[model samples]
Target: MASVGFRGDLSQAFRARIPILYVESYEEHRALAEIAAVARDPELVRTPRALLTWSPTSGLIQPDGTARRGAIDPEDALVAALRTEEPSVFVFCDLHGTLGPAVVRLLRDVAVAFRAGPVPRTLIILAPALHIPHDLEKEVSILDFPLPAETEIRALLDRMIDDNVATGRITVTLTPGDRERFAKAALGLTLHEAENAFARAMVDDAVLAPADLAVVHEEKRQAVRKSGLLEFVEPHTGLADVGGLENLKRWLLRRDGTWLDEAAAWGLPAPRGVLITGVPGCGKSLTAKAVAAGWGLPLLRLDMGRVFSGLVGSSEQNMRTAIRAAEATSPCVLWVDEIEKGLAASGSGSGSGDNTGTGARVFGTFLTWLQEKTRPVFVMATANDIARLPAELLRKGRFDEIFFVDLPTGPERTAIWTVHLNRRLSRPAVAGRLDLTPALLTELTKLTDGFSGAEIEQAVVSALYDAFAQRRPLEREDLVRAVTNTVPLSVTQAERITAIRSWAADRAVAATAPEDWDMGTGNGRAVEF
Candidate 1:
């Protein structure tokens, strides 16, 4: 149901006399306009058909305000369509809401009659959500009517700007680049929504500037939140906030602007995404947040737990809904935290556990989207246990790359320690008399050698607690004592850590740079790019 060449597809269906076509879209006006265009185009449809639209309130009506008398109800509207002899495209709007047994039977009858009748006709059901009856499943073909494309959004913006500026209602101070960014930010919005967003931005101060991009993004946030399937993540951290994983950071930095049109001109595809998996308490989830913040793109978190429903087939629909939302919010990041837990059952046969193949179906829907998605939705999925993940997920092309985030290496530990210490010690109250010198950092780094980033952070917190209890300045001994008392995951889960490392040794790229790989700890690999 992608919108690429959708008009052409609709035309083909019309010419082929595909009796019934269902379009799911929130922008009823836009969908109808497209349908009208195709129906009236003789070159496209080969035989131009008259366009008649129907809603429960308006019933069947032509473009000239000519409504069929006594056809105010859906049943009557269908009856009118069946009686009309002209080749026409009858669009029933929001008919899904009032579907009854009688209405379903009437629709089925219409489908059969339209295909075999003398004149070619098609019934188009347009609704905000799909609600085709089980009996009409084979008869109805659902067409995806996508949100406004970048070009359409840009045009809407330009018209709004021109009108406002011509009337001296607003001051426009956007450069070509800024205009492009505005359009890209509004990509997922409908033309009407984009117009409203642009109007709000222009009217806010009677002056439109680059700062108005926030207003546009805020509108998108509201739209995404309404979907219920995806959470619009407000980024609080960037890649710089992350302690280490120099290789991963570098890879991310290199692809920062690859989602832009300039990169496409250079024949570079937007990065599909990266799978970060390794020791628990490492920076896998943190990296997902940071990537979105660093890229300055909206981050949508897909909670696979919420994707499954108690209903029979709702889970697959939920997955599709989530994907559509993510795609609509593109050039954005789709973060799936703790992905292994959600899709673990999918590793085995078609159906697993008690869900009766629901999990597998949902997983299949997600995997298929991940592989075939054309939008610039960078999927950042994290996992603590890669062993639970399906092998199909680990294969090439599912993700741009699979990064193994091992326990902090010596240099990585040093970086982690530095990040935590600086963040806390920057406060005059916390620093007291402690000096964050190179020697101090080196000492702490060596003490927390096998520790994950989270453990190191907790050590700092624990040291702070100790210092707070004593009501004295933070001393180096406080940190040393904390490290001495704490046991890292590398010690308790040594076997599991070893298994993860062994799996990554050949299959995954070490998140740490080769130079930073610690042979002593057996944490990272010396893999070359």
Candidate 2:
């Protein structure tokens, strides 16, 4: 609200001097309507009459009812409207692209003439897009109209439902919870989108259940498609599906209720975020998705690569826009997968031709937002290597916790193996006949030692593929062959993996148990927080 007021002031300040000006949106129309309705001052009565700007092609016409062309001039209309004794507002609708130097000059003269008189008038330019010419940069004032709020959407839905019922249409049956979901899903959607989605929901289901949420999600998908950079990912894995990382799982559980419960009332600050830095394919990305599902919050994946652009200043603007969008739709999880690659590329001087200057600037801006942002956007950032991560990001307070996910432990391995095998057999738990006993779980875990969670899942998938081809159930030999044929991360990148575990031993929070979690020992040793 404060931001809206500040932006509104920009237009109001210009309006104080200029009777001919441009503003945006229906909000201005409603505001001016209220003002025009009640104000009775004679000086106010001298204000210009508001008019909507439209091209001659938009069926816009002159008062004389002739074809209005080549450019539908608002100058004569604005000047004549201001001649009245009644205070008025002249609106130029959708004239953003048509605004020119001649029109600007004419508006400027009208503003000067009105300022010299005792009477006041206002000319409003309404556009969804902002266009400021170089010459009118200082003169033009822009205001960003916010999308409809949750309350507004709810009211609109209620009214629409009521009207439909009154018209002998099917009655809308929406519970309070369903109503809340409808409002939440409509957050990023425009008013039209929300209306259409709600209408479609009624047409398809005749009732609004929280399950009818795909319509809302579709609206969000449409918005994301417009951005071009963001891709809405459908998460396939869950916490149980993720191998090992017991410590990380427990930590996430502690935060599950933090966003939705009594934590704030108890004076606990909102959980800031988590930083997962570890070896590749160790469930870093999987954990991010799992956390969102665990917490029952929307997941917004930030594509850092899309922030930089060929145009100057656009990168920073794009970053700000992305941040604002994420913040606006709060109580959500923000996943920045392999963030190190994107940030390092921007900051490594390779982008700026060995000049670290631009990279530093971008990094600084990001750091400030990370620290100062008050939004409840749980940033789940993953990095394969910390060598490139800036020290500033590692400082306390940026992330609520930093967890290092090393190779799976024996017990962690057993859990991972059970999860993968169970998933493969379509029996998540030990059920009738598909005998995956504790002994089989242990043997599989030990045999596939040093494998990441991803590798473990892949092994099970490969065995299942083999079974499918042969028209038989997977046997122990299939599992053994899969393990033997595959070289784990331990053997493939032994030196790098060892160094990472060593760095994480003292410097980071372990995602495994104590006593046996130390990766520096060449064997997975646990180290407690």
Candidate 3:
């Protein structure tokens, strides 16, 4: 009950004699401390209750190290709690790992006894995960184990610093702001994890500074490791690496750092997120990565394909686990690439045979999270086909905005060519050797009017390959031949492109300016390449 900051509910449970309470947490010692505090509270409970705890190894042991005669098995542990007459809180640690039919029966017995007895005796189950046999599901209440709050984490850091200062061994030179930064970075971590992160940071520099926030983030990675659902991406590319889409870039930049305290003081809620849909290779995925780097936050790519499971109820559980992982790492960017394909399974409601309605359920679970999530997890969902996406998903309040990324325009192509060419020529082997000037980029951009940001990049690579194969310096002619030989998506999928253009005309905000959007099309419109 305490780990998730639910200590206040403990009293009501005690008063109502709720049969059993379960708290899922990784920090056994910290959870024990919270329960101990709850046992002493007079406001929540009418009378102060004694605290006793049991584990498989520890059996039935009092807080003061006194061992009550009991069996080592879990069934006996519950009997021990029931037989004890004193008004007390009995915590069963790691008992879920050994839950059986017999254990469930014993727990049911303890609940019946607690509900009927005058002396309030509560059985609190503490485990890293939740497991309730169906018989006791109604009788048992599960409480979320919340991560360490900012104030709690900062106190832990201060205590660590004071200990080091008293020892006169490690340096203690953190400003109040520095301490707060470390604590904020350590958010979503358990108290034990926070202490270890602080200790590791101190050992690295002998003093705690704002620079040591990386150590705290490293600790947060452990949570990601445990959750195979969300992949933690190390963002190295920034918006500078992305070309064109100035309107989209500006929208994102204006909201940078909006999740901080200052933004809250301004009475603005964090921007929800954006849905980027249109051309497949028009920098949709690239912008997702750039935003995380530009905003200075961790990037998490959620693999939607991995969320579904064959086992009944497991698929829903996986979705919940993924959401928890994302929320736990708040102030982070969540990239769901090709989101349309991931959710396309929702429409398969056949009157015939569609199995268990699993697809619809999984999609519903994701939609609910997207609509109701209050965390700072900014979801960046990219899509290529608008029709594949559920119609309800495009409605108001799902995403802050839906952006349509078309094929690069003439000027945008010029910018894309410039970025790619400059990047290639600046390499150690070619820097200052290739005369890649604005004139050459302008010539290349004019020739590739229908190309995308990705196709433009490929054009650069093709030009380099042609030049390298000849064992000579690159000339503008090499790029000209490359563009002439390439067929852009706009040419191969003209009808589809026209359909997308018409669909997004009124429904989505064009990722490019009007002048730019009108400059490119391989259909009835002219294309030099």
Candidate 4:
């Protein structure tokens, strides 16, 4: 669940006299400070309570650094909390690992005593990981503690800049816009982590400039890599690298800044996501990568295969973990490549041999999150087999639009040839005096009439290899021979291509522009406006 403000949620729970509150977070100090703030404010919690903290080593300690005598043990700590006369907020730090039977029983006793007492008292358990025993599951309420928001991170950055500038330790060259960009880049990091990133950026060159944003992004990359479920993708190619699909490109470009406040003022909610389904070897995956680069957003690749595990009940947990990680890294793109393979079973009526129904349950969890998620996590999913996709996924509102990528048309093919040729032959060493003339490009495009984008790229690579073997400059003959020797996917899988085209005719908007679509071949419709 999305976190309401931490202080507000904690205060309400305390006011309601919640006996046990479990907060799972890596920010122990921040969590404690928030709790202390709420506990001390009568206006917030409706009752001013003394704050007390306990740890295995520290035992029971008050806010003034005084420890209760003989309360070093877990049981003793709980007993002392129960025996306390004044209304108090008792916080247990890193107690997840020590939840033995004795500790569990004592916790339950404390919960019971705190709830029944006339005075308002609350017990909070703070840990990096949650490990509530089955017996105490009903009694414990999990409260979400999210990473620092953009405003908080921005404040931290401003404070650090002021301090460094006052001491002449570092130069400040960032504009207001650059500061905002830095804060947004550090959105997924905790306050401590953000501080570290800011510090590193400042010290790297004794000055904080716009280029320091890369250092902050590198820090974020490390954090995301630690989460096993999501792979942080470094986009090396932007929309410019993509050869065609002008319609899809235009649609994506229009929604680029919709997540910003300016768009919200215009009554434009952030675009939910888009589904790209097309024949294999087309540019569906490439588009997903290019969009992230073009938008200057971090790209996270979610491997659905990794979400399903052999252990019972772990699949659901994995899905939740993946979703949480994605949400935590907000204002980013989530690329789910080949989504059909992961959700195929969920679409089948008989569960598609998944007797445990784990696939369906996971799918349900994902669908619910996709529909109701408030975070700006743009889901970019691609599918090679539309038939395998669940009908529920294709329904309106799951995605902003569905796009179909077909084999390159004559114009698109020419553009594709030009892109590949220029990318390789532009280098003097690789060019070897070979001129990339317009006539040669047109000839290559005609020779690759039915080739997919991948096929066209391979043909370029093959021609270069042939020239390399001959120890001579790349010649027209080399290119011609490579194109003539290649057999494209549309030739071998003609029936499959026809089936997918027919499916996309009425359902999906063509990726290519209406003018660029090959209407004479009756392949793709001109529905994209």
Candidate 5:
């Protein structure tokens, strides 16, 4: 780790002729302040006066007066300041966009003139976004200022809470645990944003609770929305909300505590993540959403299809930006749906001249980030087809575990039926159905063999439609008729489904039970296509 008060490092680097610095910092003002401090130190510079040229304003300023604002004739001012023959520093702010013919000439002239002289004056360029032209590559040095750490964010949150409470307008008092959790959640947020989030939470409720985190989570959503790279999805499913994944659920539950107190203290590294491969609508996506809610983490969806652009370098740039954003908001959940389609190099094999190499590169980047990232961004990737996935993805260490989401089992079907029916029964007409009971649900499960959670949902819709058409109450016959007409995925893809189960049985963790999975002897495996 870099020691505190490391301003000397930058000054030393400056002395080494490494010129332009590309810093990605949330603390832009802090960087500016540090530069000013270093400039004033006699030991750091040969002379007191310095030339600082910046944009939309005037050129260089002598060190005597407070830093001038809105400098004009930026290039000439820098030249004028450099002509003093004293060791000076020239600071250019946001000059990257304006670096054209005249600006280039001025910079080149300054560099040449300073080298000719013994004063050792250095030119420094500052920009929020980096745009490096090959002409000046060797002339520039880069520095990165990462987002504020959790400690800084915690301090900011506490101060904001204290200020609000001091005014007597906010009566909420935060518990120690609440304070820590809130700070952890705001890890990637800027000092200003951390404060704003806390203030917003206080304003929303006088008593602060973990539930108040929803307000903090909204800031994350807004940040992602502005980026145009990723989407923040509010997960409505919970552990119970997902049906027939008891084994997977147990695996998840064991680690649920890992995110909380014991894991860290026990020196248990955070669980990496999981990949679910199964038939579509078998609750692969649902499990992803439910995991986030179950673990009390924000859920972010990564859409690789949206990452590509017509412009040559845009796709890679988009992916880099999105991945950075995810890292910034760490200890969150990243859900990639139908990941096979996105990561498969063959996705763009139509030969339209789109570099299939981009897919491989992107997937490699993602894999590296997943394994090496120290932050707690748990990734959940779902796929319908294992064959389409690159072998590199299935290799160990990419994810903590890979589970196969086969069809829901008998008991799982009962749970699924109960959950959806209870939800539908919340409606007035639906609740009054004559045959809505657990016994009916058990029978329905048998009829729904090979039906996905999504398919089962459609069956309910079809049953409701049948009853609505007759202007009568829904009954078992209505459900039975709905089931009969709905040629389940089992019948259409029997061979394919069997192959998947057979392949995954030895290799992958079964999301549901494997018992009674055989086709004959009145035994049926619940699966989705």
Candidate 6:
């Protein structure tokens, strides 16, 4: 379904006698252009209205774009709007910050007058955020001026390219797919912001290659930065960086291109998401990050703490904003780390409990969206306590699969050790001296008997520190000492780990291979290293 464009939406709202429209936006010029478009189109408005703009800096402006005499104050502008004989649309720009009783009264008065009057005049209040007064809440209309669509962003990019190429200052080598990709990259940016980003890329070494797409991602991160609830993470590691979990990795790889046009043509719905729950440090969160990187999508972390606002009703709004942002940047991954922690409060979300189930309502909103969202926004949620997650979250159709991440088995541990040691030892200064043979990896793996992947990595780090203190290269003895000195979580929380494993054996799919599931078959209790 096509979304309501500015011209269509504004026209519909205006024609429907929506007295006062409060638009939250940063693109003032684009909004003005939309208003002008609405005014000029005979079919858009029943009786074409004259477009007039009002800003505190410039006061009230006439239909011809000329300033009115001494109409600087917003009060004067509202009075003039009420008195005007011609049907007009008074576009009030950025007046929300200064909205007070006096301004609100004038607005209410104008709204009543416009509703009664035969002329078609509208008082639109423009601001970056929504802050409606209780008095005017029922009367005033609120709308969001959405970011420019990909088509608009693409047009802006093409114009920028044409402008630069005409001067012979920048080189342009964009294929049709390249242009589509670039337009898609600038998806969430405003028209002006997209232009600025494109200009920055074109001027950078005077080239606009596929390599320059990173510049767009870098610039678009500003949106996530402003949203205190969602954080943009750079996922440098791919599936290859993950030591094991071949089952999980293979599942993800199969869904990697399923969201593409070809897969859609094959009548495949985009892969919804997966829940990775298990041991605390068994690469649950790492898999979330790696999936986004491997799929060539941006990763946005939803900070649940921020989503639960102290202000009533704001939590719902915040959730909606986050959802809008994620959809706007479609075909992206939305990662919620330790998701169970956020939704557990959702039991409180139903509104019947204390706090009126505000938290529960928020989770309800998220859950409903997860089940129904049409956008290709794959949710990669990680949780340690699957038991704490809402029962509905694990039901069929909520997620593609629920995979349980367990402690590394013998070979998985060996692979994990090899990955860590090689990554550290393959460095320029240590590559020559370090021996990353299969025998050494097997010995190191046995040393980490009950260790999680994180424990193994930490052991490697401790070994490096020991060698650093000795002012010598890392030796097998240092690693062995580190392993002996450290204790793994499996022993300390053995009962809890066993309980989690038992719970997952039937409920969740194993992230490990069939062979990896057979732990302690060939492995001994002693630290072999």
- lDDT against the true structure, per candidate, is 0.86, 0.67, 0.79, 0.86, 0.72, 0.81
Better of 1 and 6 by TM-score: 6
Residue 360 displacement in candidate 4 (angstroms): 1.1
Ranking by lDDT: 1, 4, 6, 3, 5, 2
Ranked by TM-score, the better of candidates 2 and 4 is 4
Candidate 3 wrong stretches, greater than 4 Å: 1-5, 158-181, 206-211, 347-355, 427-434, 463-478, 514-529
Q: How does model 4 fare in lDDT? A: 0.86
Model 1, span 1-529: residue lDDT tens: 2344789899989888899999998899888888988888888987889899999888889867798898998888899889989989999999999899889999999999999998989999999888988999999988878787788888888988998899999999999878988998898888888888998999899999988887888889999999999998888999987766778998999999798888899999989999988889988988999998887788889998889888889988999989988888888999999999889886674543554888888888888988998889999999988789999898888999998887766767777787788888887778877888989988987888788889999999999999999877788999999999998888999999989988888888878777756545323433332
How do the residues 188-250 of candidate 2 rate in per-residue lDDT, one tens digit apiece? 556677888888877774665556666766666666656655656656666765555777887
Clash statistics: count for each candidate:
0, 27, 3, 0, 11, 7
Q: Write the per-residue lDDT of candidate 4 for residues 51-102, one digit (tens) a residue.
A: 9999888899986889989999888888889898888999999889889999
Worst 10 residues of 6 by lDDT: 520-529
Per-residue C-alpha lDDT of model 6 across residues 118-225, encoded as one tens digit per residue? 878888887777888899988888776778776777777888888889999999889877787788777877777778878889989998887888788877678777
Poorest stretch of ten by lDDT in candidate 5: 520-529
Model 6: how far is 1 from its true place, Å?
11
**TM-score for each candidate, following the candidate numbering:** 0.87, 0.79, 0.88, 0.92, 0.87, 0.90
Model 5 misplaced stretches (Cα beyond 4 Å)? 1-12, 25-27, 37-71, 113-117, 257-262, 346-356, 431-433, 469-473, 513-529
Clashing pairs in 6: 348-357, 349-357, 349-359, 349-360, 349-361, 351-356, 351-357
lDDT for predicted candidate 1 compared with the true structure: 0.86
Best by TM-score: 4
TM-score of 6: 0.90
RMSD of each: 3.8, 5.5, 4.2, 3.3, 4.2, 4.0
